[model samples]
Target: NNPKKTGPTLNETFLGLLYPTENYKVYGYLTNTKVKFILVTTDLDVRDADVRNFFRRFHSAYVDAVSNPFHVPGKKITSRTFAERVSTIVKSFGLSTAV
Candidate 1:
């Protein structure tokens, strides 16, 4: 792999947050520590229920795919397993179920 083409070296925190590098399309709601719910969206048009579904999906993806061990320390992520995990999450947390 070309060092320059791979982009500059990033810190460990940044690298850790970038595991299982699969691209995803997500939609959901974010609840902060203050208990405020913030709506999130994607390029796709979705219903309230769909948003909930997406929220769950994103949560799973963030937990599983973005936390895989096989993923490299500082390289582009491209894992089919990661994509599958995200897909499952998306379906389960679809925005259509958002309240």
Candidate 2:
């Protein structure tokens, strides 16, 4: 007999954790074999500078922060870990943005 495998896709897990409050508007579709894309729209207006900074910081966080192996699946995300990662990104980018 084969053991049952259970879990959500990475996209689902990402969105579930990213939009727990349902405050974000995401419009995009991703298949298991294709690259995932997420488009976010919020009520609060985002300035060009803020958007640029966010991307820079996000890239930094993705690189210098999250463990590469854990980025795959079934990994628990913690607030403190997230905060630290964001902080690292901000510092690396020389931004004063609070994460």
List ranges where model 1 is wrong by over 4 Å: 1-45, 73-75, 87-99
User: Which residue pairs collide, candidate 2?
Assistant: none
Best by lDDT: 2
Model 2 agreement with the true structure over 15-94: per-residue lDDT tens digits: 22233234644434343334343546553343434444555455444444345555554354454666787676545543
Clashes of each: 19, 0
lDDT of 2: 0.46
For candidate 1, lDDT tens digit of each residue in 1-99? 675575324321111111222343432234332222233334343454455445554555655653688777456557787678766754555333335
**Cα deviation of 74, candidate 2, in Å:** 9.6
Provide TM-scores for the models.
Answer: 0.37, 0.33
Local lDDT at 52 for model 2: 45
**Model 1 RMSD vs true structure:** 15.5
